[model samples]
Target chain A: MHTRAKLALSLTAVSTVLGLMIGVQYRQTSATAALGLGYLRGTVDTHTLTELKNLKASNQAAEQELTQLNDELNQFERVSSGSDKAMTAFQQRLTDERILAGITAVEGPGISVTLSDGASNGSDVEQILTHDWNVRSVINELFTAGAEAVSINGYRVVATSGVFCSGPVVRVNNHRLGAPFTIEAIGDPETLKSALDIQGGILDVLRMQGLNVTVPQIKQKIVMSAYTGSLPGSPTYSLNEAIPSLSNNGT
Target chain B: MIWLPILGLLIGAAVGLVSNWTIPVEYSSYLSIAILAALDTVFGGIRANLEKTFDDVVFLTGFFTNIFVAALLAFIGVQLGVDLYLAAVVAFGVRLFQNIAVIRRLVVTQIRAKRRRRFNTTS
Candidate 1:
């Protein structure tokens, strides 16, 4: 009876170990079968599965980084193109400044006035000759009539230009010019001619003096040369650092 | 009396299920071979008991030694890159069937002899 008891005990111990192993195997097989990977469970293990998962995660991360970099690149391109537009606008402003400074040639519809020395009519010599004042008066009247540009004897008239009487010739822009002075002004042709043809204006006065002055002739287009003379040298002036009030006004 | 070991096996199986213990995949093959060896020894022990040749020391030692040797053989087969576990499985399977057959025949003969004795007493 003791031997039988021992045999039962030993057999139970062995069966218990077998049962444990079978239970674990069943659990593993069932898990794989639930995933529809029962056929591959024997070949693939946890280590390979984890490695594959890690690889997939890294691939996703790399794709995200690539998209981020692509977005940054697009932003840089947009910014550069915006800067290019600003550069073109700045260049356009510079061209306008050059035109306003009278350093660039201009063309438009305008009128021309010619004055010459007339045959003496027993009057004073000044009355029979075209004088500097006559040219100055005509230029001033043209400007008042809203002339966009003006020239005399092919010389551009800028703000700093001087017209003076020198001997028998007229000195304009520091150059000597004789009779038959042609003053060209660019503006509305009718307005420029009407400004000079006003009753008892400069044209009528010049005509009364016997100084052979012709009526202002209108033209479809008059091309005037640019200012050829050198601009005034820049003065050796330092920045006005003392003007604190005006400094703050600069936005 | 004969149901004692079967009861013990069912109880052990229930305990294994309740414990939820599991082995790693690497050692599962060795466990399978060991289980096969244990099953063969159990059946062989039953046959010996029926034939009146059962020894306590031999049965107990054979039970443990068979399990250990089967697992060791499987481990060595893995090291040697051979299918030696299949050979162990075949050997244990054949012995298990043979032992079960002998047990079945012995139990039937014992039952028949008991019936014959009863009939003679009644007559």
Candidate 2:
């Protein structure tokens, strides 16, 4: 009888353990199964689905409109190119001027300067990052060194282009750019290198400020994209006429 | 003897219900196979008790060995990239059904015999 009681007790203990394991397994499996089912069914409603479809359709329409505009531009170019000899010559000069003004994409042998943030090493964060002034200074040096055309972070440095610090980032031509900034300039490689590397130049100034500046490396061919922002319309009046000098008028 | 298994089952369920601890998903498959093996042993134990041949040592050892061997098989099956746990499931399932069938027969016979004795006494 005692042995029989012992047997019952042991069986009870084992069964309890078995029950616990079974309960836990059942709960986990069901939980995972429900999650899997939820994912399979998804949570998107008809409204969201319709919105997505409409967005895709509008994107396709916009793309078609762009293609149509490009075609019209090409046709105008072709007609202008085949007109009178004098007109053709004027068009050629206009194209050359456009290239010089960075209104058109230019490709030629040039040098690229890459500037990245320097290691902080527990120092001031501001000193370790490339600032707007650093980018502007680099562009100034490149132009002074006879760089035919220059672009900073893919934004062409045209007459009206502005680079300024906005909070933690640098804004160029109204577009925000972060490190590392790749400055590509099309010019005589040797002249650009010598001008940038002159003793106590912009590079040394940037390096002293704890910014990681790469020495300009000459590339066999560099392609720069044209400025995409709208340019100011031609002035209506001649600048040769002197404006009436403004005097302090009593309010 | 009859109430012992029921008490064991109730205790086991209580312990399982009260504990919030859980095994990871990766080991759930092994746990499932162990559960199936254990259920088989429980049914086998009940059937043995009904037949007056139940042994405490055999029941206890069977419970542990069944879970260990089933888990090990599942682990090895995973290592070999094979569904070996299915085999354990099928085997345990077949035996479980067989044990339940016998238990059912034993219960029905015992009921019929009691009814016969009562009928004879009343007549």
Candidate 3:
């Protein structure tokens, strides 16, 4: 072949190789970009899946802890309810005191008061909702009417239990409770019902504030759960033993 | 010679489009560097041909060597925890641009000379 033809053939071969490489490189780069995007999405999915797994593990651990605690309580109850007469008497008195102190769950014929937010028709929003004081007044009235035990929304009302408003919700024993508050009191059903429904009383006051109050005549079974919160420390006071002289009392 | 090269380019492109070949992601960086180096050589060949200093042996040798050296540099950079492929890209990119600029100027000057000759003949 002539030198010109040889050169032409060689140039053609080189251009062919160049073009092939460029095409392949273009396809490869695009594929790499796509692969990189998929990898990023996979990383996010992996992280979310790992977080969900961790939450499930923690929930399982908490359930196990609750079961262990329940087993311990059952064992204590079994031992306390043994066959010795004197032990039985002591156990009875202990249970009675626990019920009176709101430390034990009690169930009997009593009153169930359901308080709910009223309709807001151009009325103040606060007036429509039951507040902390409303719950406290109802509880006080029930106790004065010889209530044996009381609970608001399953939270047993004890001596140290506090009822206060935290934003739109009422907190009993530091647990947040929302309206349709079911206040259950174990007592003489007729007496408790009459005490709450008396003219110009707690029920009337609640009604005046535009709250929806429902007092069923007498629930056959009203259950009040034991208080689950720790009691606050009592206030310490120094003793004043000195007696006053009668001479100062004349003035 | 030019027509042969163009024909070869079309054939290569057709082959590339029809084939289902793929390179792995890990080697794509090296391939990209090699492509850049090859591009620089191809443009350099075109410039050499225009300047009447074109040599087939030199063009072929430079094409293979540039791709090899660029790919090797990228591999070494990966092992050394450095992005040495970026250096190859910059070098090849600058050379490619310079060659393109020279080619454009040459083509433009040739067109203007041809136009001037036509005008002289018409007048």
Best by lDDT: 2
lDDT of 2 by residue, A136-174 (tens): 999999999888889987788888889898988889889
Ranking by TM-score: 2, 3, 1
Runs with alpha carbons beyond 4 Å of true place in candidate 1: A35-37, A40-251
Candidate 3 structure quality by residue, lDDT tens digits, A167-233: 9899998899998888888989999999999999999999999999996568898766777776543
The TM-score measured for candidate 3 stands at 0.42
Who wins the TM-score comparison?
A: 2
Error of 3 at B49 (Å): 1.2
Ranking by lDDT: 2, 3, 1
Off by over 4 Å in 3: A1-7, A36-251, B1-3, B120-123
The DockQ assigned to candidate 1 is: 0.22
DockQ scores of the candidates: 0.22, 0.40, 0.38
Pitting candidate 2 against candidate 3, the one with the higher TM-score is 2
Query: Who is ahead in DockQ, 2 or 3?
Result: 2
Instruction: Give one digit per residue, the lDDT tens place, for model 3 in B42-104.
Output: 889888877877888898899899999999999999999999988999999999999999999
